[model samples]
Target: MTFLEKLKPHLISDDILIQEVVLHALHDYPNVPEEWTNELLKEAFRNKDKQSSIFIYVENQTFNEESVKILSENIPLMDPSERHLAVNLVQRIEPELALKYKNQLQAYIPKSTWALYELLLHGTEEEVYSEYGQILNDLERAGSDQHHLYITAKKLAACLVKKGWVTETEIDLILEEEIKGRWFSFNGILNIYMIGLLKLEKYIPLLVRLLERDEDSLLEELSATLISFQSDQVIKEVAPYLRKENSIIYAASIVENMKTDFAVQVLREAYTSARELDQQDILFEALCHQFSEKALPEINKHMELDYSSGLVDIEQTAYSYFSILGIKHRELALWRQVALERELDFRQKGNDLPSAPVRNEIRVGRNDPCPCGSGKKYKKCCGK
Candidate 1:
């Protein structure tokens, strides 16, 4: 049987985690059977907690009139968030048809997902201010009960500044206060995110300073925002950090997200100059995510070196990166077939393994994405 044929059994399994993985993998394989796709698509919508996984399968669907009809039948059944993803997926599949179907999609209003912020934005300025004050008072009385709401407020505050809805004078004055505060705060990271969104070149230095702070759990937010600038200046200013042990993970994410030529060059140079195999592996993995054929030579060269030096047996590593060509080109390239077979073989081995237990019927590597849908590495989660 084909991989999807083998995978069909688990797509409707009671184990939602397997369903998520199978659905996510389907994105890399676009030719799913329409009837099966519709069945699973409706089932996924019924799962409120599935979040991103709900649409992944259908996003790759080759929609025909019948498929669109099925979607029209199901659109009204979804909540707004589900509707948003569903509508967005339809647009991606067939833009003109999606526009045509828009009117028929009941309760599919195009409101922002920020429900609390939406409330805050309504009414006259004075009324909004009074309501805002009441919200603050409620928050004070609610204490830590509304801590998540507090986080939303902070992120939205930064978002407002980015949108230029907040006045320049207020931005500068508040930033001055944030600037003077030397210590780390959760709000401060959100402020950093805001600064990156503003794309104000003067604040690049501030981000660089914070990056050097080497704060844990902050690198992802930090690198994502920094790379958003997409400026050559930002690339040069941050290149040195790539060499530091504390910062390579931050730099790897920057390389992965920033697809510009300079970002590629910086990573290639870093990979070439890296002294340790682990560091080289990190940089090389980031380069492979670029999916630029130009990096293939460096990747292969390093793979050969690692194997010869008794560092790592890297044949599978090379095969995996090569396999991504299928995902990048939107067709099942030859290596991707190899990947599907490899994954099936791996799974079958797990089923046959009698020596292991406690999630014994699972096969995944440490660096591989965790099957739990947490978007974390297996090593950091259930594999641990």
Candidate 2:
């Protein structure tokens, strides 16, 4: 018998497992008549076997207009768990219809879930803020589930941001409440970052405080965001991290993008003090792009090196500097010729070395030399 033919007998079997198996088997038969699938789902719902119906609807991705109609019809009959999934599915599948039954749904689903639905349905910002603002204020400190807190906070914050209603006083209140209430999480931090992006003057100090903790969790994202301000305070707060042995490469790149006098000084100092070639190259690239008078001295110093340090590759450094400095067309031709001749000389001097083999499964620090031996650090090469 065909798989569907064999599975049909179990649909009406008294055995619950048989009924579940039949519903699961239907997933592979997308070509099955819509009427047949709808009748099966309805039968499952009628028997209060909502789990089987929902599994097919949600997990198996078999939900359709027919499924929405069935769930909406059975909304009153479903228990809490069944009602939650049914309400969610209806809202997702056909939002206008979900709006028609919003009052009924409020009685079944969690308040947080219902609020998200209202937001998705485009409730006015003032209305959303009036209802959910107090809810966040009351519940945020009680250490509620990050899921509910995030869903509510993210949308509410976005509304406030869009309306230009966010203020230092308001931001302070939000931050103070969350801090006093201890509602920190990845989502919570992200919500604040979003708000901070909109209102930096009020929030950068708090961000600076978080960075000082040096937790390494979300540090890269936080630093990247803070540096975008390009303020002196932010530069001072972030510059020290570039000098850290472990954080140098990431901090270097972030500072590179800042492309300010402060950034150049930080990178130049770090490059001079750096013991490793990979770190130096990272500093080199950061400097080459800026190519200011302050940077030229460092570029000249590196270009004067006579031998390859396995990591520095002096000839490569000179080519990068000349290209970035906008050396004229004739100078470019000469540099390319000189670079090739240097490569030939290095090859003849037994100085050229083969790169290391790539490891299929090995973990190393970002600053560590890449195992593939391109003379680049792991972070810049294979580790990426």
Top candidate (TM-score): 1
Q: Which lDDT tens digits does candidate 2 get at residues 1-384?
A: 333453444455454323432343333223355566566656667665344343333322344566656765777776663354344444343334445666644454566565565674677767766755565665556442333454455556655566666665666665676555433544345546565457465566666555534333245446546655656666566567666666665566556556468778877887788776666766765565444557777766665545444433344434544543445333445445665665456445433333434332222334433444343445566657
Off by over 4 Å in 2: 1-122, 126-159, 165-170, 173-184, 212-217, 276-278, 302-321, 328-384
For each candidate, give its TM-score against the true structure.
Answer: 0.56, 0.43
Q: For each candidate, what is the lDDT?
A: 0.56, 0.52
Candidate 2 collision pairs: none
Deviation from native of the Cα of residue 110 in model 1, angstroms:
16
lDDT at position 77, candidate 1:
66
Model 1, 1-384: lDDT tens per residue?
344455566566554434544554454333467777766766765665453455544553666666677667777766653355566555443333444455553234243323444444443455444544554456457633543344444435544554465554654666567557765444455556666667667777666656666454245456656777767777787888889887776666665556566777888999888998878877776676555566767886775562332222133344444553432433224434544465567657757764442122234544443444343444556567
lDDT of 1 at 287: 72
Candidate 2 local distance difference test against the native: 0.52
Residue 32 lDDT (model 2): 50
